[model samples]
Target: MSLLVDTANRDTLHTLLLKLTADTKPLWGKMTPQQMIEHLIENVQYTNGTLIPICRRSPEEALEAKQRGLNPDVQIPKNLFLGDLPAEYAYLNLPASVTRLMADLELFDRYFKTNAMAIHGGFGPMDYNEWIIWHSKHFTHHFRQFGLIEGDI
Candidate 1:
């Protein structure tokens, strides 16, 4: 099944996350495990409208991003640079970051049904359902980075 942040998928996502450790290395890209966790947390905050994106997309760009998101065959773009890690997350340890990620996931699950809108840095504006799909795709993309989800990307 696709990884939605609802009851059926939450435990599965958490289980995948639990398999990660401080020494986990990426099959591609350069982010450390802790940094990845922080990145995900920050992105979740963005989905929930608690954080603003670095840039906003024009109407044409937003429509294009939405179409890309809806296309199941499309892989997330590779090596997309998202700037420096936030200072607050710079010194976080692996376990703490994992804990924070899990907590943030729960918070996201709770907030997702509120029908709020958020500006995705690359995807522009997304409502609740669009954000759910985007988050699922985003999480799956990163999980594959660490080889947590095999035979998929």
Candidate 2:
């Protein structure tokens, strides 16, 4: 499976990053901007070793998640807030969603630098390269949903 890497993916992610505001809404999804920010934070946490979901609730669950028959399309998590907060995010204590978004992005950059390879399953254990690609692609996908253009960083 290909992960989104390359200049275009980075540029696109950067472009969309600039367009986000406290009021920015998903053009076709359920998350409020704050909720979306929280969702992304969770994703980063999972990428780092700090958070691990029960990817193997049973032997069957592991097998099902790992089955090659499954489509490669990235899954947009549902009821993302249903889970517990990552401690880092919960400790931030910020009321402004936009501020929290910026904080999350900063945390992501730091984490990406040191731990992109520390994988948790989207499909399975991904190396740093795979994680980076997935991160860029997912960010671009969301930004596009908001009708933003991918552009130079």
Candidate 3:
């Protein structure tokens, strides 16, 4: 199922996140629930144009990455370490982290409508639709990590 982050699916995505709790454990990967929530928030911020990366892909590389992103068979890369969490979120509890992540998702949803594009760290520049696809894949990837979505791992 396509899980784009548009008005239609925002509530559904939020509901999915509500299923997670502080005690939730991953079926794969080493991130705790709080850390996972923090990670997701950071990614959303990237799409919201609040967080910019130092490195970027060339035009040719971006084209290739975009093509790969469009491929249904291409699984999201596993165990990809984006970077360290900010100091403020270092000691955040799962509940608080989830709350913050949900807020960020809401902000991102609103920002995406008027924003022209976003620069993905690895994938490079992406239009609104591309960002939707990327965010969906990213959220699903993490959901799978926590066993929140069955048959995804």
Candidate 4:
């Protein structure tokens, strides 16, 4: 699939996201549909440095993760074990969450234009192209998890 940096792919992603509703169920994992949307939005926020998490992986580990993640052939492992969300974790209504995600993705396009990059918790620092691949894989991973799209994006 083309990266979200591409207009067509962005449109495709948005179109698929609109299909998700409160009743949608994941093919795997614990997140509700809204939680999934919020998760994606938060990831973009992280990419934009709006929500920075402490780096959990060392530089070498981060690099390894980046390399593996950027590989188009590699899918994110199921039940990958990223720890658990806070007990108080909250989610917006589904539509609102999707809208925010769309807006945040647009911001992602704008973000890289002026800034150099941001540190990914697992991928270390990433530039525009690298972010493209990372975010594309991420979206694909969750979309697949939720059974939003079959196979790959």
Candidate 5:
């Protein structure tokens, strides 16, 4: 996968974020504009010192999943298998989806610029390249879900 920690990837993410909005309904699944913003924030928060309880996978399951990949698989339960939404985020009063998305994009850009390669858990630290690869894959997944084509501007 092309690394996303570089200038090009950052620009692409920024552009893609601009392309998303509250009115932009997904082709599948359900999430309001605010919900989507919060969802994306959680992706970075996992590495930004937030404490998410391990799903208590068996040693084998964990290892197998790791071998397949980390961030992508790690995020499955959050998106595909959600728990209760936090009270704080469950109620987002975004005046407009476009405005909210722009704010979220800024927040993501700021966080990523500073600590995109941070490593949490016991896996140790990752380099920018690894971070970008993981992040780009994630962004792409959500972007596609919203019916935004891969190369569409």
Candidate 6:
């Protein structure tokens, strides 16, 4: 089986995303499947240098957050909103949005390949491996929101 828990694994992401459809409704949030995919794409923007990240947490806070954020087993609480809210989905349609997400994922991988680290608004600076762990946890969170995965990742 694919390493389904590894968000950095392209095949794993692709396999999971194949379960998503426009009609999918989040079990705990207002986001539709398209919105969720777009949100993830926007997240990639921060690491790929498409969007500049503004660090919102103090250094100590960021340190603590990074500890938690990088733990793949840690589950982000349901219905919790981060301080930085993502903009509305572009609604480019499901297929279009998936295409963009795949492209953005490529950029995300490429960026990390060349750069050692990137700044996260809440968790501060993270190396490529740290970022991969963050993405794994994050995608697991969103997948649970849409009921795409069950139990622990």
After aligning candidate 3 to the native by TM-score, how far in Å is the CA of 60 from where it should be?
Answer: 0.3
By lDDT: ranked, best first: 6, 4, 1, 3, 5, 2
In the range 1-153, model 1's lDDT, one tens digit per residue, is 355333227778778888888899999888878888888888887665566675467879878978887566787766777676555554358778777777766776676667576677766777767776777777878888888886455
lDDT for position 147 in model 5? 62
Clashing pairs in 5: none
TM-score of each: 0.82, 0.55, 0.83, 0.86, 0.57, 0.88
In candidate 6, how many Å is residue 60 off? 1.7
Best by lDDT: 6
By TM-score: ranked, best first: 6, 4, 3, 1, 5, 2
Model 1's TM-score against the true structure: 0.82
Q: Each model's C-alpha lDDT?
A: 0.73, 0.51, 0.72, 0.78, 0.52, 0.80
Q: How many backbone collisions does model 2 have?
A: 0
* Stretches of model 3 off by over 4 angstroms after superposition: 1-8, 81-88
- For model 1, the superposed segments whose C-alpha errors exceed 4 Å read 1-8, 84-91
- Higher-lDDT candidate among 1 and 2? 1
Q: Which tens-of-lDDT digit does each residue in 52-82 have in candidate 3? A: 7532778888789888976656777677776
**C-alpha lDDT (0 to 100) for residue 100 of candidate 5:** 43
Q: What alpha-carbon RMSD in Å does predicted model 6 have with respect to the real structure?
A: 2.9
Report backbone clashes per prediction: 0, 0, 0, 0, 0, 0
RMSD of each: 2.9, 6.4, 2.8, 2.7, 5.8, 2.9
- Model 1: per-residue Cα lDDT at residue 50: 65
lDDT of 6 at 128: 81
Supply the TM-score for candidate 5.
0.57
Q: What lDDT tens digits, residue by residue, belong to model 5 across residues 83-107?
A: 6545555334544543444454455
